[model samples]
Target: MNPVKNMRREDMGLQWLAIGLFCCFVILAGGLWYVQIVSFKKYEKYREVQSYRTVRIPAPRGLIYDRDAQLLADNEPNLNIVVYLDQLREDFTRTYHDLKGDKDLPYLEGLELEKDARYLTVSNMVYEASVIIGKPSALVRSEFESHYYRHRYMAMPVLTGLSREQMARFMEQGSRLKGFDLEVRSKRRYPNGSLAAHLLGYMRPRQRTSNEEAATLQMSFDYELPDFMGKYGLEGQYEDELSGEPGAKSILVNNMIYRQEEEEWLPLLPGKHLYLTLDTDIQKAAEDALRYLNPNQQRRGAIVVMDCNNGDVLALASAPTFDPNIFTGFLPASVFKPMIDPKGSLPLFNRATYGRYHPGSIFKIMIGLAGLESRIIDPEVEFFGQGYFPMRGRRIDDTAGAGYFNFERAFYKSSNAYFIHYGLKLGPETIVDYGNQIFLGKETGLLPAQETGGYFPSKQTVRKGWHPGDTANLSIGQGKIDVTPLQMAVMTSAVANGGTVFWPRIVAGWESMMPNGASVFEPEPEGRIRGRLRASPQSIEILQKAMLADVENRNGSGSICRIPGYLIGGKTGTAETSFKNSNGRRIKHTWF
Candidate 1:
């Protein structure tokens, strides 16, 4: 064997080994690059999914004010004692280990153990917190368990609506309690109590929104802080504007599912303030007038005052009122029972907008206009009355005695016979046409879902199935004709402000919250005009004189409603309704 050949063979074998080692090194480097750069974002996202949670925070609601800038509905600070679950992780683990001891317990399994540990830890903390705060506090086991299962990411509320004394105690001693703190939240409050309760409406607990942004975040939300909703009146009408845009926060958690820190990614946008046309003083006066009118308050009625020039509602008062603040907290059965009573007075009912009543002689205003427009009767023309008007051989009795009376005399006396005579002479279609012109038998479109379009006979019904008896009943705001006090106010306002009928205005505009809170939005000028009366100027003048006579004349029936310094003019009315009594006997429902 040659030595040189053997050395060459060994060198070649070493070369082959080096080549194999180089290939292996190249493969390792390529794999490292792919993992460190190409797939970095995927793994990072996986880590984030395990440790990050998104929470929704409700934005503060806007304030509500009257025309004079008086606060009607507002948000007051509410102190609550809350438990942060993430901070309690160590305590929960410690409790679980203590309960387990040195042996494996059968009950200490996944869900059961977690629930038991959480409840025990939170309950003990709540007890300790109670002593520190000097208030008796309790956390139900079921409540704690349910909260842990459903809303583990959010802070659990243990004690809510703390008073000043309790809050002071908590602030003084809260530092000693782990995972416990006082959170200041806003709560709806009506400072004036029951005043304008129906107009201001009430608020309910926060609920999840159904807006577009909320829909996108529905699946991503780990915990959602609720926002309040308006249940009625102006609050309900403008819910979206009053409840501002919600903000979002992200919580960075540890491997143990405990929160390390939280950052607000989206800041809340505060809601715009609302300004209403209601005058506080006038509203109080109207409510007081209604209350004192009848000592027993058995007389259920409503009063509505309006700005004849602009159609802005000044005051709307309804009897059997309730304090809207009752809805803010847990309502007692004593307070709640009467409001829901079906057989008794419904205090929740807004009589000014919802109640339907026979306008009685007030309908005579429309009848007088119809007669003057259609040339059926003159204001000075005298009609002979025999204490009652004859209709289809039946007599409709009048409060005014039999006499040869003109329009002014009959109007001041509220003569049913005189009005009924003109009502029949004008025919049902002519009268129904005039009623429809003023938006009778139609919704006023003021307060949504809070108003009703009272019953008014259609022209078709009067023309197709016409009857003298029906005509007679319809003549004096009876039979099928019914109206709300708000509607009557509009009618009165139309008479006062020439022939233009304006849509009733409740909310004046949207205002800012800053000092001097100027209006951001106002109702359009044309939005206030509902319709205009087709009556001639002379006709309106005649009706105005007759109405004034009803208040100023010596024989006036509406003299009781007269204010000494004010030369106010109004007409009085009485309506009769039949109903069966508890003894099954017929009884009359009289309204004056």
Candidate 2:
């Protein structure tokens, strides 16, 4: 009697179970729809943020050229073997599984095992690359591990500065390797080797400044290419103009962190080219002249050639130069040590502008002008010398010997007695005033951070310690007087060009390189006058005539420097200097 009722109840229970299952299916469907459609963009954006990466691309540095459009400094393409970490992820996973199965290997776990796995995979790739390039290459374990941990998004460099043959080999075989690629980078090169090293200066790897680091922290970039910075000379002076603006690139990556495609977000703006006014031919000539003066190269001196009409430095040469290319990368102690050696010739020093020397009889030119201005001596006046002059209870020797000397004869003979006599009469103030007019006590403003304004006694210094002996010493270009070869060049140019002092021009102008390979920029004007000497035309003309006779006359002290039919006028003199030796004994230094 209850069988039919029981069967109906069982059917109802089954119906209830089916209805509950249907309800659960509906709830799951709604949840799937909410996740797949309602918030699809949000999760997609999150995935993109995790997978994609931004990279910073460094712009190429500007080119440097000489006055005649000769390439001095330029960038050369350097080939490098790079390992794309994104493409190595799958290999890293597969290698990790294989490594885990090795029973003979030491127990490794967590990050340590993962690091070994990544390094092993990368090392194998490097070995394969080396074989293809026909060169031996290796990856440091610690370096690879550190890079994997900190800079996995960035490509790891396996081989740098590849030779042309090696680069060609890699280009052929590297495409077969999944994560391997060849990258070309611009490297700074000096085409002239050591020529004009001191004037051109050098470069070093750029480091992120505090401000740059802070700015980078605010932006998003997964990798950054290395940059360079100018260290000295014109390089340092025009750093901003030479270092171009950096650009950015967006790297599209897959879910496994493999790079898919890359697009440059911003194009790099290249730096402007720097054109210097240095004449290579004249520079070589000036250097050659100095070398000829000291055949053994033991003598230290500087020679400067300038355009008399404009004060443009044609050449500024100093002995004992160095190659600037060594500073482009890591500077070894072997290369850098010699430059800093106290006992060495100091090849890094720009002696033409930085070296201060006693002008010797050369100062007589200024003394002659001073005497003329003070009316103490006329160009035609004659005086007698007794081979020496007695002063301060001591007799000052003269190289010109005892004779009756006019201004022309005394200057041509470099008569120290003749000039010293007039110097005492003209006094220190008037002489210093004339020296100031020649810009003797001030910088020439030619090369910044590469010039020294040679020491000249100020009126205050003279007034504080006024003495007849001091006046005599100052008159002969000794005592407190000092001059650079560059200053002497300027002085000589002023004498040649009727008293107009021009600010020495070095860098002619800048030219900007455009994408179409065309250059654009304004040229800096030539012959910018700095100041004019206060000497009257008549005084300048008299000084010029004396200078001409000093070289043109057969018995002139500077006759040795005379050129045929050039009418070149010059003065020569010797200065006495003393320095303490290593044993603490004073030693005399004779300078010409």
Candidate 3:
């Protein structure tokens, strides 16, 4: 045989083997490269789905301050012991034995009793927590399960509203605890609980925001953080300024359950401080006056005080008001029944700016101006009113005994018959002309959706088959006329300020944090000149003198509203409401 040819064959076989090995290596290397680099993002995304969770740490809510820099609504620190469900994975698996069994375990387990075997595993952890934190572990098991299923990323609040001592104890022992963390969150608190409930309003739970980013962010549903939304009053009217933009926080929670660190994506902006036109001292005085006026507190009424010169609402008070703090969610329903339900009463109702009533004699002021300007009635001329006027075969009586009356005497006595006769002479056209010019029958157009527009019959409205009877009814503020206390205040203000009607200002301004970490704020007010009285200044002087006589004269009806040092000119109103009596018979609801 040829030894040289055999050696050549062996060498050729070795070469072929080496080539096959090289090809295998190349295939393996390509697969490793795809898994490690080319498709790395896809695999990493899958791992994140199972292992990583992004948590939303709520930004501290903005604070509310008054004009004097006094805190109206502020935030308080709330200590809560929270558990990350992602950390309880192994324990939950061990306890259930079968993840599928978790669905049925809740039904079989007795939620009230701590002795049930089904709850033993979860209870063991809870009981240990109770011993360490000094709280009862006999909580409803359903709460823990619901939190686990619904909100896995949000920290599970186990112990709520803990004291400072308890928080300190947990923080000290947190190193040994596997899944427990002490969370510091802000809660809304009003230092003066009921002081300005109506003006300041109360905080409510976070509303469902439509923003896609808001849904991506997370917060505990079980426990309330101070994400208060204004429900009524100025808080609601100026909600955007009071509820400044919420800041963003990223909580880095590791696999072990403890929060590793936290960073602010956007630093929390403090809510803009509001400086109101309301004078706190004057507000207190008005409130005291209202309570004093109705010592029994049985009368449902309201009082409003304003700056006639500047259009600033100094104070506004309503009867049967509730503490706005109660609306914040600490009290049970039972405690709030009488106030919330009120049976036939409405404690939460803001009667001052919201309640609509007949202006009574207050309407006479506008009527007098209308008649005097239209030349239908002369202020100097005398009318013989025999305490009543016969209209459409029905006689209407005057509260003030009528006689030969000049304009000044008629206004002082509030002679309904005289005003009614003259009002009819001017007709609904002139009356409504003046009324609409004064912006009556419409809102003052200040804060949107707050005050009523107050109604008055228009000429166009009356021309559409309207009756003379309707004009007779409206001559003395009856039939279709309805006015809010704010409307009355504004009406009176126009008269006091010589015919320039201004919007009533409530909320002052907003306080907010700037990009440079400095606080920025501005004033907000609604001001406008609605109209000028078309009457001669002599007519105004005649009415003004009569109004003064109504307050200062011995026979004046407005003596009750007078202050010793200040000249207060006001008119009284006694309205009739539709209500049922004790005998199941209908009767008039009286208002003073």
Candidate 4:
């Protein structure tokens, strides 16, 4: 009983000590809560510093169309691959540590080495991508370096324009392998190849302009990627209206890559369609005729067929054209650029409204009109024709050889002497007045960029050192008087339509998008008023008869222009371009 009591006293003391230990554990837990609850944000920030991601969102481009609602330029599905730089940092550090290979390396001791290690991280990623995609690749070192140095948040593009097979392989193998992604992008397509190349135009590599783009990040486009903009023609002029606004997306990104978590922004807008006055069938026809005449080589020629009723240019053809599609990609030396050089021929030159040539015998029509109005010459007045007329000591030759001629005979024959005699009688001042009275020597203002202001020698221009020779030259459609085929067509149209001159138009109407699909807007006619010719019906009748005879009469110079069942009025010309060439030799350039 005494031994038991002594043991119990010590055991009782040990039991009390165990109870105090339990209470101390509770106190330690409460202290832990006090510190952790207050400092949780700091620890969360530390974790975020270890792993966070950023991604980029690409905006969708606008659609392009032809006048008839044909899709000329549209986006095709393109698969793009990009890599996130931030996610690889941890792996890079681990790789760096392994590469050091048991060397005694203090943390943060090698600053330049760390930079190299960072580069190696990206390089390894590229190597892995190359191996997975079966493509030879490495970091475009300078580009990578620059991008990382400038914008660390931006996702780097490893590859673009991936094929369907490649994209499938990427998704199946590359995406699962990590740090690589698949994205659908839009690529521009031209469905008709080279049709309407000059008119539809082509695009160049351009960044998204701030005014055209919706978001701010979109404007920070750091690369000069291939994109197209209309360079010339109607395409260049109406680019803005045709190129609709670009839409944006706010991409939700985790620190890993361009994950495309959510497209939290605006939708894309499609472009409007354009309608032109050009009839594809007629344009093709006109082009065929020019080619048929000179099939061996490209001849410097133009054709303009207009609807005399309204100023609609049914067809305007020019030789030496290019397919607009080629301009969108890499332009070869064989195309539109060569002609622009000073030494090059510029065969693709639009000559319908642009080429200014001496009117030649065609001007005799205007001269005949003026003479009939002046009453200096009558249709019945027979003048004894000589092969050449002596004028101011210079002899002017007639296209027709010597014969007795009335106005109608002279007109049908295109006698230079007869017209010269009448043209001089009208005086250079009246002729100049008539030239100016019509829109000659000025722009027709149809397409200013594609047109020229034809020249007419004014009295002021003539009197400055005026010579009777100059007047004589003017009499036969030579000297400082030049006109475009378009101008001639206008004159002919005026004669056909009772003397109302017109401004030529190419666009008939435009198509717009309705809620369902597409809708077309109508076209309005364009033209101007030139002075009305107060012609005697007899005079007009005589001139019309001569013009018809010029085409219908087998002996007439313009016999080739005669079309069966169609009473055609016509004139033909062959003119010389120069008096001399190199090597001190006399030469001449001719057009038939």
lDDT agreement of model 4 with the native: 0.67
lDDT tens string, model 3, 1-592? 9999999999999999999999999999999999999999988655544233333334455677655667777778877877665665566546555434435446435332222333455556656666776766564678865754444456777777888887777777655665667887777788876665666677677664535645554432222234667777777876766666565555554443334454656555556666776666666676666567678755566777877877777787777566777666676777767665756567677787667777777788888888776777788899999888788898887878867888877887888888889888888888788777667778765545556776777777988987877787777777778888878888778777777677777766766677777877766755545666676776666677777777777677676556789876655544455667679765542222
lDDT of 1 by residue, 339-373 (tens): 87988779889998998887877888889889888
Please state the error at residue 257 of candidate 4 in Å.
Answer: 11
TM-score of each: 0.88, 0.88, 0.82, 0.75
> Could you list the CA RMSD of all candidates, in the order they appear?
4.3, 4.5, 5.6, 7.9
Clashing pairs in 2: none
Runs in model 3 with CA error above 4 Å?
1-12, 15-58, 86-137, 165-177, 211-226, 249-268, 295-298, 330-343, 580-592
Q: Kindly give the stretch of ten consecutive residues in candidate 1 with the minimal lDDT sum.
A: 518-527
Per-residue lDDT, model 3, residue 392, is 82
lDDT of each: 0.83, 0.83, 0.69, 0.67
Q: Least lDDT summed over 10 consecutive residues: which range in candidate 4?
A: 50-59
For 343-408, candidate 2 gives per-residue lDDT tens digits of 988988888889888888888888988787677888787899999989978999998999999998
In candidate 3 the C-alpha lDDT for residue 25 amounts to: 100
Q: Clashing residue pairs, candidate 3?
A: 272-511, 272-512, 273-511
Which of candidates 2 and 4 reaches a greater TM-score? 2
Q: Which stretches of candidate 4 lie over 4 Å from their true place?
A: 1-140, 143-196, 207-226, 249-268, 332-337, 462-464, 514-522, 526-541, 579-592
Task: Give the poorly placed runs of model 2, Cα more than 4 Å off.
Answer: 1-25, 29-48, 51-55, 102-110, 212-223, 250-263, 293-299, 514-518, 580-592
